[model samples]
Target: MNARAEAFTRCGSAITTNALTKTFHGHTVLQPTHLEIASGEILVLLGPSGCGKTTLLRLIAGLEQPDGPNMIRFDGEDVSALPIEKRNVGMVFQSYALFPNMTVAENVGYGLKVKGIRRKQRESETKRLLALVGLEDYADRRITTVSGGQRQRTALARALAIKPRVLLLDEPLAALDAVLRERLRVEIGLLLREFGITAVYVTHDQAEAMAIGDRIAVMQRGRIEQIGAPKAIYHRPANDFVADFVGTMNRLEGRVSDGILAVDAEHTQARLRVGGGDRSAVVCFRPEVARLTAGPGAIRARVIATTFFGATQRLVAEVAPGRQLQLDLASSLHFAPGQIVAFDADPQAIIEFEKDA
Candidate 1:
């Protein structure tokens, strides 16, 4: 890590929350929740809209006070009752939130300016932060004069200027276009790891959360459903909701008996070695895990459509009366609609859940 990254690591603080609960007009948006973020870790809170991710973030930032008896701590210091201004935390919002009248440097240095720092020291720190975000040359440019990505960089620089103990981001990249979003996702991930600051990021996009977070907390109905690394969350989901939320999961209805899962589909008798005592179950796997094969004992389906991507071809096929399956194949493979094809999933990759799952 570089000098700037080292500086951030020196100031980073571990955060702990105990029985954190939030209520709005008698409706509890966040239940009694306990979370611990290690120093220099980036934890992403991922869920759908109104899932309490933002509420948890606000509670941590002291923007919204939690119910009594709940505690928020920074490096063992209890800050549950501290207001936003006193918490020494940095926040970045979906809206860039830069002052319209301020130039990039002025905006980045606004925190120091508010704290009554000397002009020389504030200018030096502002210059260093601008360099850290690769916006050194844009210091004199007005906020409206820069691109969306540049404006976001300015916001980040401003946040870091205050030497915050923890960083809170609420869909900071949600406003960018797809191309820019993808590009900045990588850049932001590198920046977070380099800075080594404990961060809590809230987002509804699963891909973004997986790409940027060290670990993800999947939330639902104002509670955390699961918390794990990206690979663990995708491959070993704790329940049905998490399995379906993280990615495209293809499911098949079946009955398990004699160490075999027999799928219910016409023209296709699919059976896999799933050891479950005679009971109804659902076998789920990702689209990429299923492949088109000509071997026997594979599930048969009639191709409905094929969409061509640069590296892979995605085929939508009808497996049963109303059931459809999606499979990703090599782009070189050619198949017309209505053509029958047999596909099989890797036995080791299949996940068996209860019928209700």
Candidate 2:
């Protein structure tokens, strides 16, 4: 590896934020928060609009000042007062942000050139980075001449050329089509890990978060609702919001009796076996937990619709008069609307939350 390329693979920065916050006028957009990002780890901030994910990312980048002082540190060094450039943080936005007038190599090496690196060294480094991003053959191609995925790679190459201590990406794949975005996200995840840079990604897409993040922080309102690994967050959500946001959860709201929840207690239909003792409770489980069964005692539902998902099929079934549940079955069988079906849920798959949550 070239000296320049080798430098990027060195240990990335470890980040810490203490009581970090941001407020505008009289409203606080980001409440007091604390975060720890391990060296070379990728942490994703996942949430919907106005969830403060972007606000938190910007604060870490030094693009926006934190509401409090001594709140951010890089490898234990206070860097809250540093500006974006001085902080040595690389940023990739949704837009490619490549220089349309310049060739791909020129755009990737622009940062090194601005740092006063000599032409010979800059060209060598640019060549390496272009090849690193698999665009070696398109060094002289203009940004407008390449594919969207290539342009995205160019933007990333440009960011990494400076060997920044950290990388911040905000919805970098938001501009691409669904199919292309899906394909590129895997490529991007591999690229980021190859560089071993501490990265903070902000995105509202759950699938994107699951694919890219080593740990995902699900933000809500002005604070982080939960942070954990992708499977941990999905299978064991911290609360109702996290459960509902991370994926499709089938929730049954009714009274539990004798470790069972029956939507229609008298008919014994639509049961989600649970352990609430005996009280009004909401039983939550993933769509994959329920499976088709044949028995008079099994939970019964009337299929409202079915959506085929290639390897699996999702059924929207009406459990009660106004209650519906989504079940995913690994079956090629077909069921028409209004067809009565019996199913059973794994009791271990049940996720319970406090009523207030």
Candidate 3:
């Protein structure tokens, strides 16, 4: 086996968190959380800033202490008291933490050097890691001379040098530009799959979470609101918060009557099939599910803006006096400002939540 594959064989471990809680000073930042991650699974902790995703990651990495002991485990071994350096966990951060004075190879081998590994073995491992990351030719280049993406790859390689049992990444792509971030997201996902190591990735970007995570844990306030695969989280949200947070959700305010819900817009009315006993309801659907049609019972709207996105075109139309609805259509379809259009959402695509929900 190659050095990288050999290293990975000794690495991947399942992780479990039991009642993991974190409190700062006098305030509790993370509520008691229990999670189990299978070996070689990529679980993403997704939430906004200050929502405790980072706190949970730090706790797993041993950078932050939990409220009590027996709270964290790796492959059934309790490691609550272990420190960050002793946890044997790899970490990659948003800031490329590369030493400016070191070359790419030097940076990749720093962890092994600190462990007092033999110079020859360290060089061999570093060479293997560089090749795995597709930076074999740039090993001797100075850290300052490499591009942002290269620096990220170096950081990843360094983290893997120790053959860590678990990997913790905290917003690792937030600092990169949009294009670079997209490109590196795919690369990182592939690398994680190839290594088959348990990883806990933290990110506030929903798209990034969907792209890389095998399963996602969506956090809110101090607790996880939902945990599921990308498709489940996107299509079958646990609550309104989850539905609104994962993607663009279009809402129609209406009242249910006679087995049908009628949405009264400024100029037209939209009907939806919903179950409720003549009560107020808010129907929600994604932008991609809303379609423009000329049939009756469609909501009348005036196109206000259109944006071309190569594969698809997005249209923002005023459905009410001050409210707008957004929909994505085929790029070949033409839409112009001030043009009146009628649109309807499929019954199967509409999700009905209580007006106050």
Candidate 4:
């Protein structure tokens, strides 16, 4: 297909929810959420267990009902009260959910069969889907005999069988091993792009979310903390929770005063010349922003610990008597565990957030 044709062929439907809220047994499982998932975008809901990421997905899939006021709209029509079967949505579960007695082709063709596609058409579509997932050779293999990756592909093909407008993947990669999960995450992402389906993928794995999502929503305690592109979510988190949860972060709590941020009483500490006023605030800096060098604008620190990765090293240092900070550096630095080092950072790299600011 030509570029435009290929792009046009890969487009799917859009989904949105307004002030979606859910509660269970007097506990709020999903805080009111308003989100717009663009057509053909892969949106990953990421958070720890009990954070309601799955609950939100269930609401969108019409598997869970909204409490009140909240609404789910598909392509501008209200679908909050729609039934699961009538939602035109495909779902892939963590358990693969394939029938043990059915062959791979049978599993892939089951939906088409139920939809009343002719026998010959079902066979042709099954063959095409099997080939699309690179499982054509395993078309007749029983579910029990296929590998986990193959099973995942089978589940995906089966979900795609009915050609639903929206696809919901509920921790689908959780069943695979780490290596296979990584591999399939990429494969599934590619397949979603190829099929042009709008997808809502739920996962707690940060790496998986980063790898597969075009946009990610970081959730906590039934509420979404931030939503943005992967890089924005990682490098420019919305708040302290998002900053600390998405990646390794060092928190310096203090009060911002007179356009400067100070951590402790003795003004001889690493204070940030900020643009905000005096208020209870927290300063955040990623390890990558801290340089292991001695310069005019530097903080003298004592290395407390060092953990080395293949190509990089993470150092935890004491900048003040009781103040600690962390740094990530190249392995070539050759710094010892107990060595005294000077850390420098550009003033602009510092992010200051008032306690209520």
Q: For each candidate, what TM-score against the reference?
A: 0.96, 0.95, 0.94, 0.90
lDDT by residue (tens digit), candidate 4, 1-357:
334225335446788888889988899999889999988889999999988999999999989899884389988889888899898788999898999999999999999998899999999988988988899999989989999999999999898888787899999999888999888888888887777678999999988899889999999999999999999998888888888778778777776678666666232466555556667777788888887554444455778888898788899887666677888889888877667776665567776665664
Question: lDDT tens string, model 2, 243-338?
Answer: 999999987677788887867632346666676588888778899989787754467888888999999999988767667889999767888898
Regions of model 4 farther than 4 Å from truth? 1-11, 255-261, 265-268, 271-280, 320-324
Candidate number achieving the greatest TM-score relative to the actual structure: 1
Error of 2 at 249 (Å): 0.6
lDDT of 4 at 317: 81
lDDT of 4 at 120: 98
What RMSD value applies to candidate 2? 2.0
Q: What clash pairs does model 4 have?
A: 10-196, 256-278
Order of the predicted models by lDDT, top scorer first = 1, 3, 2, 4
lDDT of 3: 0.89
TM-score rank, highest first?
Answer: 1, 2, 3, 4
Off by over 4 Å in 2: 1-6, 265-268, 295-297
> After superposing candidate 3, which stretches have Cα over 4 Å from the reference?
1-6, 275-278
| Candidate 3 lDDT by residue in tens digits, 1-357 | 445565586578999999999999978899999999999899999998989999999999999999999999999999999999999999999897889999999999999999999999999989999999999999999999999999999998999889899999999999999999999999999888888888999999999999999999999988999999999999888778889889988888878897577877776676766555788887888889877787765777889999999999999988777788889888999988998888777777788776683
Q: What are the lDDT figures for the candidates, one per model?
A: 0.89, 0.89, 0.89, 0.83
The pairs that clash in candidate 3 are none
lDDT tens digits, residue span 213-303, model 1: 9999999989999999999999988888999999988888878888677787775687655565788888888888887677765788888
